[model samples]
Target chain A: MSESRIERGIGLLLSLIQYVTASGSVTVQEAAAHFGVPEQRIREAVERVFMAGVPDGAGDFIRFDIDFDAFEQQDVISVTMRPAFEDETVRLSPREASALIAGLTLVAGYTEAAPERVAALRDKLRSAASQGADTVAVDTLAVPLAAQRIRDAIRDRSVLAIDYRKPGAGTQRRRIAPVALNLNEGQVFVEAADLDKQGMRTFRLDRIEAIEPTHDAWPYALPERERTVTGSAQVVATRAAAAMLRDYATSEPVSVDGERVRLDIEVWSEPAVLRAVAACGGDAEIVAPASLRRAMHRFAVDALGGPSGEREQTPRD
Target chain B: MNRVEAEERQFSLLLALVDTSVGFTKHELFVRVAGYQGQPVGDALERMFERDKDALREHGIVIDVVQPPGDDSNQEARYRVLDGVLGSPAELQFDAEERDLLDLALRVWHEGGLTEESQRAALKLRADPEFRGGLPLERTPGRTSDPDGAEPATASILQPRQRPRESAFQALKRAADRRREVVFDYLKPGERTPRSRTVQPWAAVLFRGRWMLVGHDLGAEDTRTFLMQRIVSPVKDRAAKQPFEAPGDAATTALAKLEEIWATASVGVHALPGSDADIRLRHRRDTSEEDGLLVVHHADRHLIADELTGFGSDVAVAWPAEQRELVRQRLERIRDAHAEATGEAAS
Candidate 1:
């Protein structure tokens, strides 16, 4: 087998080994069938398993007797390898960690992956701080904290009392029946009764401040007209938000600071308290809303001008 | 390269990157190439871009320099490069089927949220070489039917293509290149603990989308499965005291086990008393079976408890065990603090 192919085969063997034990054995013949490899190739791969003890003192024998025939028939073989009673290995290479880190790193920014080349430059030297870091910060993306309570109170197929904050508008707190928790625009939205109107309206998670789940459960249809405004855009206040703002420090208006942009945003996030954080872009970008997030979408936007220069708006005439 | 040739070649690369189907604006194309050139700002270079575009077109290279939505007001029209016509006269356009698919996909994506990654992917698709046929439906039924030779493997700063096995090959290469016997931890399935093992590295490979390393464990005197992702703090570039040898186990391969790490990392948080049971959350909705239980997905029970504790006396953890006891204590403490302000806890 090619060196790379052998590596792949061995990796598969290790993954299978995770399921095997001193008392249990994964058969080679069955693995061959599953892998669509010859029995000998399967044996070569299985023999790569981490086990102790040797038959005839060679250590090359199936540390324990494995029933090859039974394995081929049943697709599982009994293991006889004696436990070595040693520690296991779990260290991944920088490259593998890089991939996983790239995937999960979005949990914080919640923004999707950036361009690959840019990601590589950013990923270089910036490994995930070990789980043993001095401090670990936390936050959420899909839902806000204040509304969390109200959302729970709604219960499934139940009536809800939402203390909602409107878009650059006032607060409306009322009890309403809820139909569903769905997402529109990658944002989680709730379809429930707009208590005053007695009609169903979709509330963004960010806009919900307080939720009271009543004991009553009922089913209702989502009003088709209100579907357009499905979910709310929420901003979270977190240490992660702060760290990201620091990263945003790079995109601060190039005109203002060599490395910074004038950060100001007007977002529709709610719960008054949660909106006050350092999220990026237009999500509660006030410098004072310490709890609010500062969001920046302008850089990524394909507009024609820098932070300065009035957008050449077409003459209304 | 002459102005015409340079522009033509640059557009060629750009077209290869983003298939003809997904067109790019002049600004997008310029920024992408500027990134390649380290932001060269000069009128001469800009002029070259125009000249080369025309030359490429004359050679039957259909490079459409398009000006996207945001008008720069240069009033000078711009175009984007697509397929190399090599002197053909037909302007390459999306056929009905390709147009339909693109429209539906774009609608779903736009409605979902203007996801930046999706947009980038779409933009890149426009210049990709794989977009040979007029539209995907014309030849094949499957969506995104780019012929094998035309597929564009995009790698950008924000979006890197870490295909399966790439990591494994890299790790194994590093190990072999350095000749090191490394030690690391492996989290197995149905188990709570991650154990450490010493390994003599032989090779690594990417099977699907993850890395797998095949190495001989010193403790086991045999080979084992090592999931590339599950490995932590790998100390690379060390020498192996012993030589390499093939293992003789008659069971699963090491590579498969490495791939199983995620599904196998059976981890449960050490539940503090408050996090032990289902907690009833009060939303402004009616109660249902699904909404009744509050699942604290956190691996840190205390952290979950702390969050629950924030609700003060309003929430309670139900059943499983008297899980609310911890929260109750917290509430009592808060209540006492308030009472001290008003002398209630003492009462």
Candidate 2:
């Protein structure tokens, strides 16, 4: 797990103050007594000692000083970290990280586990990420597909024309009024009332060739207040494209100020509104109205450095 | 690992071993426990094997049946923990013998002394039942080192290198706990060894699996890592010394350079290593990783770099600029080293 700045700071303080080379430096019982913690807790606290040090001032190693020749003795840590094993690291521990990665690779070369724990593992990964622990890229055939769009449509009771392919059908075809999408294995299965079947059927999205609005809309409209938001991927894609262009902006959504999506994100581009617009990936309009867009166009022209210079043609959809 | 004692402590040890393994197979149970029985004991072993599961289950340990392979006909009966029971925690129930092991671990972590089978015996606790509230090790056991009843003879332990006397280790520990910078009247090991040198203590460590005292040698005006075993004599300094502080963990930032810890860097940029993504981080020696991380370090750089190449997308770069550069350079060198190492440009 990644450490928080405070946790690391505390560790730094402890390392500086309490990392004694005393023979009884860290006894679980003693630590528990001194810290007023349980055995489980103290062990957890003590395990941090394993990751307690930034090795060699470069912050490369999560090192613990041990008194054994790793090459000679096969301690648990040493065995797992035996110069040959490699695993994807979640945080900074090379042995565990490499061991895990190596293990997954070894496992991947063989079998697939039942589909479960995606969210839990992802949550663990997210927690580790929060603590600044980088997760090893684990390749699994069991991760659930992103079903945000389907979820939103379902939540809103909006009509969806899904291009779906049935297993062994050998091809994809269109359908109407999808209720939701559920993930089974790595692919998404759309749950919709099929007109032909007049019943609920699951269609794999990957098997689908396309998606479009049918000539018909929803049987009943969703109230505006009940609509859900889903655009992280889209926003991220936009930011990545901006970064590719060497100009970028990042924003945190502010109050949904009326119909406008007010954002208090940091901006660096001169045409601030355009950069903001670009960051939003067209989901955002210049709700501040003429002033925001006009200033952006002017800045775009200014960036081009002349009124007729024609650099204003920024590729925005 | 003995026969007579194994029979005497068989029930307790077996129960304990069950707690340790979380679960054990019948074959494994036979090999470990019956292997301890020794000599023409196969008949008795067969009896124990049949009754072993029932006996262990009586002691709140269950041998779980693992899932059979889809294609296999003969089901491999695997053992595991019973539901709602994670067995024991180590600190909870270490007996005197196990406590002795903990004591040894404590001493070495403290005094920097190594002894015969201490690491081995202590390692055994890993195979013991997780004890409940064994003993608090935070406070000193009152400056009194317990006498191990079954101490192995020194002759049994080959001297791999130099070993500091027990007295010296105890002294260093006492001084360090008091937060006093110790003046080592250190006698260096090997030919033409010097008798003594004064130094300001920063931290004492077990490194490369040997005790080392890190201190600023005032005369030399430099920090040095001194192996404890190499010191023939070490005395607390006469001069008033400042409190010794271990170097911030940043010292181990070099751990990423170790071969075994390289898989954490196995990421390829486009999120193509299946579903999980990888990122590179440089955790300095002081950067602590809590969530079940494994780290390794070696004096060899190339070995680590070479090992890092296989992680592919599962690993990330998380460290020293030079190490990252070395990884980058090593990837470049892969072109020249192995023919099959076709260039795979990863972002």
Task: Give per-residue CA lDDT, model 2, range B22-111, as digits (tens).
Answer: 455545444444233343546676565545545433222334566556735423455554443331222223454333323332232222
Per-residue accuracy of model 1 over A1-317 as CA lDDT, tens digit each: 11223223223343233334422555655444333345675555444342212222221222423555655576565554433212221122222222233333322132222445334433431231111111100111233454344334343335666666553345677677653444322244666666557567766664565666665434344334443322232222122122223322323222232212233323333322222321121211233232221122211121112112332222111
Q: DockQ for every model, please.
A: 0.02, 0.02
**Best candidate, lDDT:** 1
The number of the candidate with the highest TM-score is 1
Q: Please give, as one word, the docking class of candidate 1.
A: incorrect
Q: In terms of TM-score, how similar is model 2 to the real structure?
A: 0.20
- Mind listing the fnat for each candidate? 0.00, 0.00
* TM (chain A) per model: 0.36, 0.25
lDDT string, candidate 2, A47-155, tens digits: 4333233222131333444333531243211212211001111121211222222122212211122224323332332232212112112222222222445554554
* Candidate-wise lDDT, in order: 0.35, 0.34
